[model samples]
Target: MYIESFVEYNYIGEIAGLLLSGLLLFVMLYVRPKKTLLFKYIFNGTILSIVAILFQISIIKVANNPDQYYNKNLFGIQLISFLLVYNGILYCIFSYVNMMSVVRRNQRKEFILMYAVLSIIYVIGIIIEIAASGLYTFTLDGIDIRHFTRYYISAGIVCAVVCFIASALNRREISRITWHAVCLFVPTSLVVLIGQMIYVVKAHYIFSATTYVPIFMIGFLLFHNVPYDELSGTQSIYALDAYLMKNMGKKKIWVVYVILKTLDIENFIKKDIDSLYYGISICRNLENLSPSLRLYKMSDNKFVNILEESDPGKAKLIIQEIRGIFDKSRVDLDVPFNYTIIAGELRSETDTILKVRQFFEFISKRFIDHNSSQFYITKESDYKGFSEHYEISSVIRDIRLRENLDDERIVVYAQPIYSVGTGSFKSAEALMRLKVGDKLISPEVFIPIAESSGAIHMLTCIILNKVCRAIGSFSEYYDFDAISINCSSKELSMENLNRDFMEIIERYDIDPSKIRLEVTETAMFENYERANKNMESLSSEGIQFYLDDFGTGYSSLERVMNCPFKTIKFDKTLLYKSLHDDRMNDILSYMIEVFKKNGFITLIEGVEDESQKTYSVDRGFDYIQGYLYAKPTPIEEVKKFFNRKSSF
Candidate 1:
């Protein structure tokens, strides 16, 4: 008989395969990465594989037992057990494919239906197998194992076909890493099919291919373990890049970029609140916007939402909803949150990754420029703005690399400040200008970009050196007492700012008193302790610190009094407002009187005409600066205004 001719049990290969599978199971339980959905499925599948292998070994042992009772009931029990193990493996493959393809919550029904179909097929195949093989002899030698082999092969083929069709239909939605992992299962299924077919032909004991299930699962775990942000419960930037690479240009989509600034996590902690919970809550809210929207936490405070929607109006409405959520949260939550939400539809089919990244960079620039919430970037001008930002960032990077100051890429201009007491322009503010080919880019355009790119420090150093050089060389030809260089918040917060500034001054052999550093109230407050230390150290070296842009920021007169400042420069907006309202004029006069009484020199800038200059001088302003006296000009042009007397 066929059973008598069959080779002896392949105990060596079977035991080795079981040991390997057991080892993989141990690793899966203890050595896996984060427990993402995919990881859990693969882990469970591994457990099932180990169980099936043990059952297969037990069946082989029973078949080889010389004293075993071989009855129809026992045969039926073994066959059913074999069927359960085979079907369980098939279900594992189907679940993995379904998880990859059907990500939307609403599409879960489809996944259940697909699994139900596989289950129905298995039930029908089992019924037919049992009905067709009824009334078989009770002896093991009389039974044909080919009947069960046929059922196993048929089920494997059905599973392979279903998984392949599902993967093909949603190939674009699945990431490249996931797609490769899914494809690996195809060959694994084939191994099982071909191995079983060979067993039917030769009637010989062969190593069970179920052993490879754990190996395949290990490969799956390694390939599909996606990193995610624990706080927000969203995938990390790497997953976002993979998703964008796969889906971009395949369909129209909108990207909503969210940035949360000024989180004040320490403050929240002091109040016994979990600040990270807010981040997670925000992700949950945005995810609720659409079933298909995929959210990724790019960093601690930045999130990206990919929406597979084609309608621009719908996208805008979604953006508005995001804005509303933030606005409401700001008022309703105990901790006030600062958020900027920018959304735009990705129209270009090509260069999707580059374009999306550029848009994000642009959003960052806008956040810095305005420092406000609620931005919608959907127009052509917005894209052009991103292009311009990219170009300016490139230019700033190029300028940072150049060593020679005479390369003319970075130019210094001076706007003369009129001294009311001296009746002449004794000091000039040194401003930076960038010359790209023949076009000169405005400081407003490139300064923010420079700061964002971390090139502002270098730019500040270059400008300071040039200003010191100008004061040393041009002081003899031009009669200016000092040149004021603008210092940014980033520059003031530097630990070595005083050292770097003094080094430049000494290199040019100029008096530290010959240079005045103008810092805005905002800059001073950004990192108050650091800025104050740097300012005090620099002031002790005779480089006077002037509080620029007063009354335009979080102005605290008490805070100002604590700092060592020689002059207070009121912003032009205050001067403009004082001219229009009598109350404002009175308030400005009182402010100027208060500062003068505090023994501080007061300067009112933006004096456009004689009336404005006279108004400032009469109000006890020690200095006046604006376009009326002299616009910002090249160093050569500034020499003409040095000794010129003010009309006021």
Candidate 2:
């Protein structure tokens, strides 16, 4: 059957497309953020498209010079080239869908197997088309038009339909860039399909489909693939934020936050490559645990997994499995490593990316403070704890911003310290109390949050100012030697700590001698140089520094002696344990003697009963502070203890 073939091939347009696609390929490879697995797939598709375009250009060249290559079986070669071009275009479409599946983390074994089957069928069809059509009839009118069978056309339609179905099924996972590319692709593809049908009816050559390959490649590079950590190959925190914002109300997500504490130490010691390898290994193992898990590396030591899970129980089970993975890794590795995992179901109805990030920080701080391996915010009570922490953080932020001591949200209480030598209440420790509505939030609960959030310095300054006020107000009537204020490690490391403290004490016209700063052994050890400098500068101004929570930290006696501390406050745990164990009692006595010999005033806190206080006094402790003398109370309530002396 002969027909009037009017469709003409545009060699110039085809060549322009080939050049543009090649340039885009160069740009993609040169400027890609990372050579991720997804990038490799897209890169392969681009290369295939470029090859297809080259084949189309070669066929056009051969057809134009028909007489020059007449003996080359030109028609058969053109037919094979046409099929190969369509095959490349179809593979590109499949690759786009595969990248989307990768982002969604829903690429299951079944999906992969189906893809493999479709690919095999498509390739086999190409082979069959070539074998079945060794020679094709052609009319060498103006342009050498090949009259081919409908095998390639039919196979292309079926493959295109399969790709369309696969893409539709994962439409939700398609990124904005992919959607835009699809929007452009649909109209172009329709035009190509309509033109191909027209060409077939008119017995003309079909145009190449590689013209728009660069569009998809550019879109994928610019909009689709998110930035990932170079070391761990996990998405960045910014990507997580974007993902959360994009999928907020669309699906239920549970975040499994993992922190490798040992890896953090490793990173500090410049073993970053090894730490990242360990982190990447953990991520791979976690990804293997679930098909719908997407991991993001939030920081050096922290990883976040977004699980598409609706049930809290199931999420907890997954988290437990994750903990087991970490535990097993610790046991399997040559070096011992410790890890913490905290998982909580995201409230899609009300949670924002910021809130989710804050939730992560809150739980991380809780884990560090409690030293627990795993935590699941699956229960209402657990969420309530988070809510309380959020509220307390808000209160602290308000206090810091307002700088109003009269707000009453932040209150200060004083616990009296009894002097064993003079047998009188000679000193008091200023403690922080946060009044949230009617109930008081414990320091144990909010202190770590404050420290983690960088609000501890503000809290420290407020407490110092309030204590100075109290000392100035009650010193006329009270006979206390000094009021001790607790300083956190974060506060001690502050470069402006001395300036902030001196300003407050100077403002109230209180003697620096009347203000004693209580620092934990851990705090001093955290940034020894800065803490020591701050302590020495403050001590030189007549403010005594007390090494608080002595036995709770790892500090050598020589280090403690070199520190500019006037006193050592033994922790309650040491006192309680020493009372029960005779060996501990001897060690405690020896420590007190050593400190006293070095001209350090020694105090044993947690002296509750008569026996404990008597043991403390007999051991020659200079001071005692505990519940047995006086529980922490308001500055006004502590006045009665000023004149009272310990019976012991």
Candidate 3:
């Protein structure tokens, strides 16, 4: 006989059992199982199976006769114990099979049937063990034990076979590492389970070896493969970053950064469970819409879609499809929400992973400040044929890469402001221009960068001081009335704005009356008291203030009335619309009359044609400024412009 005797079996079982128990403890504590349901079942089954083997080892110690021919009570206890442990193992296997099926997007009817059949078999085996039980009482090699039942062992073998087959059929549905781990478990478990049934091995050794191997495999797989987000099943940011880096230089890839407008982030996070379900629901909706669009969570109320389409038009079409999804389902959210998607091509040649991440940051800052719910497409058209597909991200990248801090690259251009009555140039607005080598950077590009970098105030000071010096240097050459410099919201809120203005004017030795500060109504409305105080302080010092782009902000007429602005400038969009529409002209005339009655000078900007200029003059506008007079020119060019016109 090859099997061990009673004393030898006990010695081997205790030594081996203690070592396996330590391994289990080490894996459970160090490897640390994931909180997934499949892992939970596997962990529980492992603990129960190990305990069953321990019970089998201690059976002889508790029995009345160690070498007895029969012990009915011990037999019943061992039969019931092994049967329960086998059933648990089978149940865990079924659970894992179901999990694989769901992940594979397969019909789970087969898994359901398998679970039902296995449950019935386990119930029958338990019944048989309770009603009729006996111990194998032969001292073959002096080892006393019960024969391993065919029913219980066969059930375990069937489960192993089913798990192996499922894994093979759904190979692509599983990760390579995960599939390999499953393969390591299923074959070894099946062979050991069958070997125990046919030959007499120590039951403690068979169960412990089979269960420990699979459990360790599962723990290793879970520890290494990180797929789902901690809060939901969506792909995590870590996965997103990895995928982006892998496809970084791939051609014709596009990513759309989506912002959920009106989403209350604080409230959503407060209700964490609902928020997790909300994220899952969003992923489900995206999957239902287009599985090709892989959604990744970017922020609390933001998501991104990465796709590989050669044509940007196809990406746009996908964006429209996502819009349709949002339209159909937004009302179902617990709170009202809408989406603003910013999309462009993910260029290969010039972009890196860091540049792409910076692009997202730029989009997020713009979305918060604008609070707009419309799709903003920064397509190839904006790049002027630099590439077949260009993105706004490149523009942001250029701005960040710029190292022009000393303001040497900054230039001031003057656009003539003409008197409507005389049609003669008197004042000119100082527009800030940035140049990189010979290329002129658009205000649309640099202004937002300035705002985001917290350098708008510094940029304003630079422009203001430069404009003053330029005008002061040329104040003798031409009888110029005043030069208006644009001020951003940040500049108006500066505590030392009044001092900054006075010091610059004093340094240039220029008359404060010759320099006007131009502000938009939005700036005044955002910080009304600060703006009002600064406006009064500067106006008292002989510097004038003009409300630029009036009627385009959220401020009411009453709020505008309280500001110490001496002039009001109409925005180009409002002027053009009023010029084309008779109803809007009547409203425009009413606006002009209201400002005129309040002793405020009204200037209508964007008068680019004879008809537009005629309308501004006919409406009794105090001043007119647009391409109709002259495009923005340098300070020297402005002097020559008036010198050549003879109107000055």
Candidate 4:
């Protein structure tokens, strides 16, 4: 009789097996399995494929009735060996598939029952085979049958049980394709069932040939059909900015005007871009909640929600309630959520782009600087603090974007920096002031808002362009002393910082030494290595650094080691509190002394009162800056102050 084998069997089953094997191998290769364990799965599947061929060969031998042609001894050896191999292959398939099934579902009760049943039957079979072996002298009609019976099958069953448990427990962490193989293993297990049906060795080839249905189906499922993405399981999100800008032109981008409440949004949602799209989806639902409302994720952790330009107050109420959903959902929520937030409201629709950025920036700044304090917009009717001023800032944002010029919206103001010991002006700190209509606004009012909205860089360029021009106007009046421009720590971390600064410095025809960069402790320490490298590069080229706001934030040894600033600028709070606090004076004294010993110059900020100025002079501070010297004045005032040394 002819035998069925991949080697000998020419049935549809064998052809499908070969084709499927080739496809699976391609997938394994495509997955780029870099790890050794993944290769082990490949090796195991290969071993199973080889066994199918071997089983086919054994069937042909058994069907020939070899004892009639050859010796009975040869027939017995062949017969027993084939039985053992058949059982071995069956056990392997059963164990592999069963474990895969168990792992995927993870029902311990069901697993235990399955294991018990499989265990009992196989254990009995193994015992019968063991007892009939020659060692015990037991035989069937005085002939031993133990070798042909059960020891290997029992061991095989035990191994299968163990593998099943391990695979079931680890389904998720494994690769999707591996899990595919794991889940479909149930059908692949027909090898064992077929072997069991054809218990006699003579039918092994036929069973192997007919068993490709499950194999073909599993192969189809593994490569051709699956829900997960073949690569990253999610799409890229960097296109978001471009997408919004391209789709919604400046006029249609009206979402910036709606003022939402404080609701913390995670910058990077746990899932990928597709997952983050859900936040936009929920925001889109706002339109239905109020037909004119518009929403989109402006940037990471920042969303722009707009209402009608004609009716901003009506829009604000609707948006406020929508934001309340986030806050209300925080407790025992149906979904995993975080409600911490700080929001900035923009009143002008023209400032749509800038306003969205500012909302995120405002919150980010609180996170970046204020140690998790929340900045919220209280109602104009409820609280009269900075509501009107905040609205004015929005007006300024729209103006800045609209002009796109070397001058407009932002005007230059300078505050004289004086030598404390001599009480003579040394330089002027260039302050950027945004003007909208009849109102003149300080950087303190709009600069922070600019930084929060990611428009700080744009503001910086405006200020630098103005500062350079402002300096050009004053260049002939005095020898160049440094003009310090306030830069965001976030901006420092932006792309090509050194190149950007260099270009600005070169364009202004300003000496690098005349520009002293100031950074707060929080900004300096946030990304110390990048900061250090940037500072070190600038410092090497003759620029200097002043550590702004010492004695605030996580002030530690790391700041001292990492920050290479040439000057230490004391925070206003510390100097203000120093007058009343004896211990605080000691702390400030130690801080100043350490900085002094390091050869860094000290400039104490916020010398608003005589006592504070007297304190800085007595404390050996090299310079002092604040309203005590002068409130930030017009450029002409700064020129006049620096031109006349004894102006104080």
Candidate 5:
């Protein structure tokens, strides 16, 4: 070969080597590089290849001809060439071992032995080159003629063996480019293997290209997808988002919500798990029918969407289907998972991403606030103004931080519970007040925020503590009967709810019987087993139990039969609607009678005037709780309430 053509031919080889070396480094970055002894060889191997390229360039650019300046440096160039080949092989060896680190069983052992054998074959090829081509020769240059034979032929053979070994380690992940290289290299490596029967350098170049396929593919793969390490299969939430984005573009987007019953799962497995796949299955079930709906994982427990194609009627239908799945489940937890999400079709799109995210944030907050049961949706405008008020709400939060802050920001108020026969105030339900400095804010203003941020527990504790303390103090002055405190279902999970209540009652020396606990149907179902147990213990110690909003929330006759409650407070639904609706009247009559026969107390709620009052009196309610007696009042005003009823 002529000098210029010789340099040009090998330069292509040098470029291939450089790219492969760079790719090897790139792949190693995410593969969790261990500070191993072999990586040192791999590093040196790849580095010296750069020196070989520099030596070639210097020979072409700085030297005149073979017999001129470069001839004296032939030994140096030759050594550099040896180092490049040496390092390239070492890199392949290291990468193969690193790649196979995760392999299991005897296959891993077999792989290690195969690489060891390939290394031995490389040594034998070097010995063949030494014997076949003289070890050194020079035409104005002292050169190892055999080195070229060994370097090209030996590497080609090693590559073919390694390629076979590496191909066997294939995983058909769409994200892996090594597999792509195997496809390209395997045939070429075989051709090179056939060509090696006759020792010719020209034939060696064709096989050499095949041998370097992995390095080229690897370098290219560095710029592309890396499976599991650099990039992994979508996380549950991310997968949900990707699916939604892909399917639904600008349209009435709808979401498929899933609730996971992971309690048993968490108990069964101790290791960290990517549970997104199971969650995706839930979306898959929903999409199996309503294939076009967009979805996104709002959180671990919730996913949502607001496609441009969605309508309220269609949204409702999708929600019902998802719910029917849970409703029919034979295993309770599998049916009703820990997460209950509301998927609202977003109708509030504007021109901005911030608006979109704000809309999503608003959607998520309202969805979580929905609390109980089933996949569902609501219009964005219904909640838009509600969140809009938060512009002024932040200032109120600072006011809430003041001394006796909660009390200063909130006024404690109570609504009287009436004994129907006696026409007297028997007990009061404590409600929170949010005040801006001197102005009182309604419970509706902050309870949702408190609940969402997990501040509800602290707020609940404070309110209950104050109510108990005040009633205890009030008892010292007057013969106050008793007080009722509303508890969220979440409160039942307090580490020692029984002990906390016991301590409060014990601290004030208040009779546990004098303290009644009211829980709404909205909150009654969760922690039912633990709640009922706690209530039983409290009742055993003398506390009273009242099931609030009885006509609502899991309100089947089943709860009346299954739940342990001394009293049922019929929801405003029953009392307000009973007058005109005969069916409601009949149901109310049936409910009152069912409780009466069971010796359960019935409290009619939401009576406003004589018309509703007359209906409650006719309905056989043991008691009533509503605005008819008086709205929730301050402690100072309780005296006036009792005095107004003094004539009784």
Candidate 6:
């Protein structure tokens, strides 16, 4: 076949090679793949290729102008060219093997041995070929070009065979591009070498440019295609998402959110090469427990283990094994890192992918301040309406971002609190409710949002004002004593605590004596002095104060005594425990007596049935507040239904 003249084609190939190789280097540097070490070696390999090309150009210039520069440097140039091109190929092989070692953990020892053997072979080849026979190349016209020597052929063959074997061994473990690299790299390189030999025999200067084409292809094929983290060898978050989505219904998946407890996550990620060692050690420990635990790194300090059909007990054992890694008495690593791991487990059913996503969303918001590193197992029962939770979170985010709540969206619910003995509607506790387009958001969901976003104070004020308006309206029909409103610790902590309470109360022009304020015992303990001051200040204004959820706190009696409470509402947990124990029942009865003697009205919450109500009233409870009377209802509904009941 006829081709273009040697001189023209040679110049085109050289210029084309330079431009393409430079572009490869630029792109590689720009992307900055995770395997920085591998990137460095590839970078060195590229630089060597460029240097070999420059040496060929220099030799061409000197050969043309025979007396312009020293001719003796030609041998040195050839020697250097041989060394660079030879080691450049070796470096490529080294990077591939290293990647295989990282992806498949057990192959590390075999990889190391293979690497040492390859290194020895390359060094011996370079010393024998370059130092003794001096690269075995000849000048074509004026340009010093390259051809395959016995050393080059032998070393390349050994490297290719070993690489092909490594790729075959890790066929399933490595990515498609990596597999393609293993398959294509050796053949392409051998083809280039053969072309170099043919071109040199035909007296052409094309080998230098042609040889680098395969190297550039190898760089693009391997570096960009690697799918796992360069440092940890764990699946990247992106890869995990894709895998989970692809195998959506095929696996019984459980995600274990792993967090490092001892060291700050940012610091752990930023502390140089130690991060790699720590990650490897943790992964090793996890793998030792169960090979099916596919670990993925979620962030700098958080790892996720995706298990197929793994039970909670197995996950717990894996966490325990990881924790044992840091124990000085149990195991010693080369670089012993000070890190402790805590894991949270959530299982996903076939149709519950949305639930897992919602869980991830919830933990993302709360996990930073969570210092406890214990393993927490979460099932569907823990968060039944996962989509609703996600919606609530989005609502919270919107609320926080907007910082203005539509008062129309805020609601007040009231549950009737009746007298245990008379079965009369005595009073009702005003409960806070929020709704978004008819979807009622539980206080359990939005209250935390309020507390976190500094909106609890506003929420309390809204509730108090709404209750006041509702009570004034209800008073025209019913003979109830008062409508009690719940106050949060955030509301009590307000600097204008007294004024805030009175501003709403006085606006409604309601009787202060008829308005009761219920504060949780735990709320008072949050800031005792401030809570006491707020309670005393409100009490001085003729507002009756009740210590709500009394037995739930550590110091119930102390709170009542320090704060001037008119009543102490016993939590139902106390009642439930007293059921099986006669001693507990007696002690509860005695406590009620003691409170009544001290001028404190004792009320028991959670009276669900007639028997509980009878038991409580017989035990000296001044009032009973629970579903035995009614669930929380809107003010309008409460008026119509209760008026009928009273008439009946």
Using lDDT, give the best candidate's number: 1
Cα lDDT tens digits, model 4, 1-648, are 222222222234445554555565566556553232123333355455545545434434433333434344554455445444444444434433443332222454675566567656654664565456421122222222223423443344354446545656664433344445555553345345345334423422333423433443353343223321112121112233444445444333333322223233443243343334344334434444665554433334444444444455665566566666555443323334443343333434213444345434433443443433243543444223344445765665675576454756778888888886565787777877877677777777777667655667777777776776667666666644778887788877665877877787788686778777777778866777787788888888887887777778676855665567777788889887888999998988988888788788888878887988888889999988889788888765577776533332
Candidate closest to the true structure, highest TM-score: 1
C-alpha RMSD values across all candidates: 9.1, 9.0, 8.7, 13.8, 11.8, 8.7
Q: Which pairs of residues clash in candidate 3, taking residues 3 or more apart in a chain or in different chains?
A: none
Worst 10 residues of 5 by lDDT: 226-235
Error of 3 at 447 (Å): 3.6
lDDT of 4: 0.55
lDDT, each prediction:
0.72, 0.71, 0.66, 0.55, 0.55, 0.64
Where does the lowest 10-residue lDDT sum fall in candidate 2? 140-149
Give a tens-digit lDDT track for model 6, residues 1-648: 222222312445556666766776776678765554456656666666667566555544554444456366665666557555656656565564546434543455776676677677777766666566455433333323333333454565556666677668755555443555557766776777566556654655454455544554465444444445433446667777777777656655666666555445544454534444454545555655665667677766667777665466776666566556546312443333333343444434224455565575565555556654344555465555554665665565565556443365668888888775566777778887777777787798888777876777777777777878877776756666777888887777666879977988888788887789888877877778877888888889999988888777878565577677888888998987787789989889888988888888888889898888778878878788888778889865666534433653
TM-score of 6: 0.61
| TM-scores for candidates 1 onward, in order | 0.66, 0.65, 0.60, 0.46, 0.51, 0.61
Ranking by TM-score: 1, 2, 6, 3, 5, 4
5 against 6, candidate with superior lDDT: 6
lDDT by residue (tens digit), candidate 3, 510-624: 8899989899988886778888888899999998889999878877788778888889998988888887899988999998999899999999899889888788888999998
RMSD after Cα superposition, model 3: 8.7
Pairs in steric clash, model 1: none
Model 1, residue 93: displacement in angstroms?
Answer: 7.7
Candidate 5, residues 1-648: lDDT per residue as tens digits?
Answer: 222123212335546655665666665556664333334434554454445455544433322244544454564555445544554654453454334222221255675576577667665765665567534344333222334544655565656565555555544221133344455655665565456434333421322332444543443333222211111111244444444456444555554444443445443122222232233334445445454543443443434543344467866776777676545432332322444545555444422333344444554554454445534455656457544545325534444454232344456788877887777776677887765556666767677665654556556656766777776666655544677777777776566788877876787677778788887776757766787788777889988888888867875677656766788888888776778889988978987898889879888878889988888888888887778678878854554444233333
Full ranking by lDDT:
1, 2, 3, 6, 5, 4
Worst 10 residues of 4 by lDDT: 227-236
Q: lDDT value for candidate 6?
A: 0.64
Query: Is 1 or 6 the stronger prediction by TM-score?
Result: 1
